[model samples]
Target chain A: MKQKIIIAFSVVLLLFAIFLIARDLFHSSHSMTDASCCGDDFTSAKQVDSTLIGYKRIRIIETGLKNLTGIAVNEKGDIFACGNMQVSIFDAAGTKTKTFNVDSVPGCIALSGNDLYLGSGSHVIHYDTIGRKLAVWKPYNNEGYIASLAVNGKYIYAADALNKRVLKYSPDGLLLQDIGKKDSITGAPGFVLPSLYFDIAFGSFNDLWVANTGRLQIENYTSNGHFQSSWGSSSFDNSGFGGCCNPAHFAILPDGGFVTYEKGIDKIKVFDPTGQFLSIVAAAGSFKGNSDFQLGNNHLVKDIAIGINGSIYVLDAYNQINVFRKKNL
Target chain B: MRSKTQIYILVLIISLLTLNLPAIQRFPRPEFEGKYQIPATQVTNIQPAILQYLDIAVLIACMSLISWFIVKRRWRKGVFWMSLFSLLYFGFYRKGCICPVGSLQNVTMALFNHAYKIPLTAVAFFTIPLGFTLFFGRTFCAGVCPLGAIQDFFAIRPVSLKPWIRYLLGLIPIVYLGLALLYAATGTDFIVCRYDPFVEIFRHNGSYFMFFIGGALLLTGIFIARPYCRFLCPYGVLLNLVSRFSKNHVSIAPGACISCKLCENACPYDAIDKPTGLSVKNDNRELIKKLIIYCLVTPLLVIICGWTISKYSGEFAQVNFKVRLANELMTIERKGEPVTPATEITTFRSSGKPVENLYREAASIVDRFYAGSWIMGGFIGLILGITLARLTIYKYRKEYLVNKGNCLSCARCLEYCPVK
Candidate 1:
């Protein structure tokens, strides 16, 4: 009787302990829902203050191009949307004006006077407005990814996302120097492009503005490739950029404001000349049904361009260019 | 008599094959995005390189002390106190990492993957115990191994199980050893470390399910006495084989056994073997017939098991992370649903890598599993055959002796010896 009681007690103890283990495992595996793991945090961040939205989308131009890479605007108010091995030009009224085929898919496009420059893979091809190839610049290296191109009166700065540096080249395909290299003497903090989202544009003062996306800041450099100043902050709020690498694409406004497109949070924000929190042009909630449509590769804003009328033309993931105008306050 | 051995071998093979089947289907874990962080339950202190060397030094010191206590001193109190210290230092202080039991996976991984550089500390931790076991039996298990020490501490009312129960459970560690090696060699996972119930208890933080498992095992240890060491530990299989050939081993009596049978009842782990008198009239012809039948059946069993396990090799390969990810992607594509923003899938897409590359990698790993499963299955079959054959052979003895392979050299039976 004594032996049987001891054996019975041991069995019960082990069974009770095993019951606790099984309950925990089963409950944990079953109880996890969309909101439990991560949805609450993401949904909460997507909630933007309606009053902070300073711009209303007036036009959404449906470009039937697949895999749209970037958008650029010229002084003539012509919008050049590049993707799917072709460049489509649109008038300020969102009418398709002209289309031209490139030898390869262009990562970015820039305009200087009447000439159009396309960063097709490593090679940069110069084209006239009429679609005639002017010159093809050989790749600085085979592994270079010329993600963004900025044109000044004297130099063309290409943001090489693969090389993590800005390539300063002459218009005629001459490699002048490399900018944004980590240097203590020049105080350049180098380019920290975690993903292929590095962008460059010329500011109003002729200083080259580069998006240091990994550091969540837009840095200003001299035309001769010297570090100047940068502006941006990392936060979950509407005024700041959030994600692994934000400000994926940025364009200078006609009034010297900054139009920045951030991924992950999928927000288009604007800032003053000195990087003051200005207003939100668009948030993730502005998309279809206010749902996080990160599925189907539609989570990113793709690219942004500033028109001559200060209209913000956004190349969204759905292959549509959304045109936003300032709301009448 | 022949049928008994045959039945035991067949039972073992069938049980192992059934247990090795594919896991049940369940919901996939949801991937979180944005700035969400997993709640911090415990902060793991990363050990420095110098501290890892110190761990190795402490392991050597404990093993030496336990061997002396068992052999030279024959003091159970010394062994118990030293193991308690090992439980504190190696278990609680070091957080139970870099142990010899877990290092078996590292050694297996290095052997198969040429790119993998096995750490010098892991190589030492894995080999030093085997060397000590060959010379001084399983003194390491008595006081050095924290996993064994923790279980030993919890064995308050150790019960000796029946012989058939012991035999059935003994096959588990061998099978576990085979599966652990197969997974490690294929770069699947270090299952030994992943499922170690006591490691979480030592760390005071981990998955809640694992915490309950640790508690359950400890509760079970109160009756079974170091249940994991006897039935679950893959590393114990290696020590058991090496200790069988040890030059010096723990003995119950100092000089001669008077057949009091007190030490037999005192051994909680059932490591003591009673002497069997010689049979005057031997049945040589019957024994020869049984031996002949076993020889013919052993090779046939190996081939059968190899073919059986290889049939389900693809299912087993599902445990591999790369293979599972490929399957998930293929499922999503087949369903024609929009690719959800699951973290793994999105990360793959943003990396600009082609989907075809992932499919090809998963296929290659599955193909490797097919070949590996055959060898693993055949090895398990051979172990069963050997186990059954050993039961048939009897050695003549007139005195009680310690079963070297089964003994942990803990010296608990030393006090029960009337002659001493």
Candidate 2:
């Protein structure tokens, strides 16, 4: 029995090795398919085009946002983004919105109707869509290092990047069983080190889509957290997330297109719903930041929202939110 | 009839790739070259650091192959030449650049973020060792790497880890994968560069504690097995991965074992994963399951917790807040805001040309691309871990190796059979 098992094991290993080499050799066979569309700076061009949304391009608003990490959209279409010790909100027309003061670093955000959920050092605080504080949802081991957050129906999901799992909770702050990454059926890397989840929104089918900060990839999971599809990685070119770990966050447009915010290179890129990278709404060169600060910390750009008629709102880290009116859409 | 011809063809291919190295060297791949202005592509990276590794890697490949062909039948002698060559190159000629293991950075750079990466010539250097592993087994470990050469010099008495402990330690490639990505993600110095013990050996010092640990291991390598070859060297792991799947394999002689197990007993790395007298599936299943479980739990948690932590609560951040203040302090040197440190470096690099004024017009570019980064780490680790573990778990049956399909018909192992 041992002998047979040994041989079988070797066979399995051999087969696996063959699969890897074959895949590797064939990688360039696709050979940068559709390079034509992305070349000549198609993505960079889209970031500033008026049709996609105004936030697609990097714009200077009210400056002096230090470590701004999270952004959200309310029912009234007002824009709010989180920074160190403060949250900045803006109206729909590129006007100066209100800025809220807070004590901790706000890393993630979620908006439900008039209620906004923000993550701050192991505590989840509730606010009226108008930015008024309501209730607090604190986890058992909440150590303030929350990386990303999402709200689906009544359930809220928060990734404890350092702890390597996502905590599920009810709106009233009740603890639910954890969907630990280890429990995931697909064999994937653990999220021991989590960064920003730029955007998290309910899909048409209610599944959750996540654009992870450090991985430069977006992974989709069942509302219950079963792993499904994943795409994107660190890159400067249109096909990949630019930088060591980027495409930190993203927003899914009402039309199912995606606008991703990356750090290392500092740009926002757009993609068709099916994952075809389209264009860059904005590039980092237009923005001013620390020499070392590519696109990290509370550098939040999560405010991607479609208006009643489909205009897009982007909450730049600056005090004012930028609005884009799609000429065609 | 044409195995040698195929080998020559591979050499030719590698040579062509090598010839293209200077072009790649002169024009640093855009990924590694961060831009000076906004919309970065227009800027080019020009640095001597780029060419440092390429030159040595080519020389090592050239000389090592020549020496190996000369001493084709002498295992230890060939290893001596290869290792001596690595030591001279790394010690006297090269600094911290072209080691084949470091080329992992290039492959992984592309696999992960497709950012600043190693040139193709650098890739060929790694391929050369990998190719040698296929054609000759473990010579890469015997010498050829400066890391191995340094350790070989200090090898003394050794103690072996139990098979299980060795197996557990062998799983380190996974941790290496995680560390490489973590540092890369942070835009920190390459982890391999910062922490390599051998680089320190060549450079003459390292972190006191880590160096001592490496020194002790090096001392322990002589009596038992090639300790560094067994446990810590990432390059060793890389070569081993290629060795297992190598087209030409090490053909051990019949009765060479004598079942004496001296080589096994002397071996320290515990690279030998003996089949648990139990069924291979029964023994290895739990470990595989745990590996899977560990991988999935964290990302899901990151997803959920990242959301929870994002919910903002108070007014401290409203206007000149503490977090904002701290961020500003950290960013001051880099941003337009003048600071002490960044000013000094730029000032120094330019011989006191006001730092800010020089880069004032230039905008930092995005997309520090390293091609095939994630995949490179992921694949290499997976391949090495799986291959080495498999080699340990099952000793190839005598008949299986004797009748091996891809043997270069070189019966070289037969000539060196000390036991036979």
Identify the leading candidate in terms of TM-score: 1
Worst 10 residues of 2 chain B by lDDT: B312-321
Q: A105-153 in candidate 1: lDDT tens per residue?
A: 8889888888888887777888988888889887778898999998887
- Name the docking class for model 2: incorrect
Model 2 spans with C-alpha error above 4 angstroms: A1-67, A94-100, A130-132, A183-199, A212-215, A233-236, A284-310, A317-320, B1-420
lDDT of 2: 0.50
Per residue, candidate 2 scores C-alpha lDDT tens digits across B1-420 of 233533443354235324534543211122322222222121122437446456645555644563354234445445544555666665434644466666666566655555666566567765766676666555555555666565554433334444454565555544454445433443433556545544544444344534554445544544433444454456655565555565544444344444333344333233332323345545566666655664555454444433332221111111112222333333555565431122123223323234454332121101111222333344544444444444434333322232222122223334434564
Per-residue lDDT over B1-420 for candidate 1, one digit per residue giving the tens place of the 0 to 100 score: 523533453354235324524655221112235545544245455678898788788888888888889898999888877876887787777778879999999999999999999988899999999999999999999988889888776676788777886787787788678778988999998878877888877665677667767777777888888877887789999999999999988778888789888887777788888888667226557666777777778888888888887887777777777877787678778875442345455545544568999999999999989988899889877877777666556566678899899998888889888896
Off by over 4 Å in 1: A1-329, B1-48, B277-288, B338-341
Candidate DockQ values, in order, are: 0.12, 0.01
Q: What DockQ does candidate 2 score?
A: 0.01
TM-score of chain A of each: 0.84, 0.67
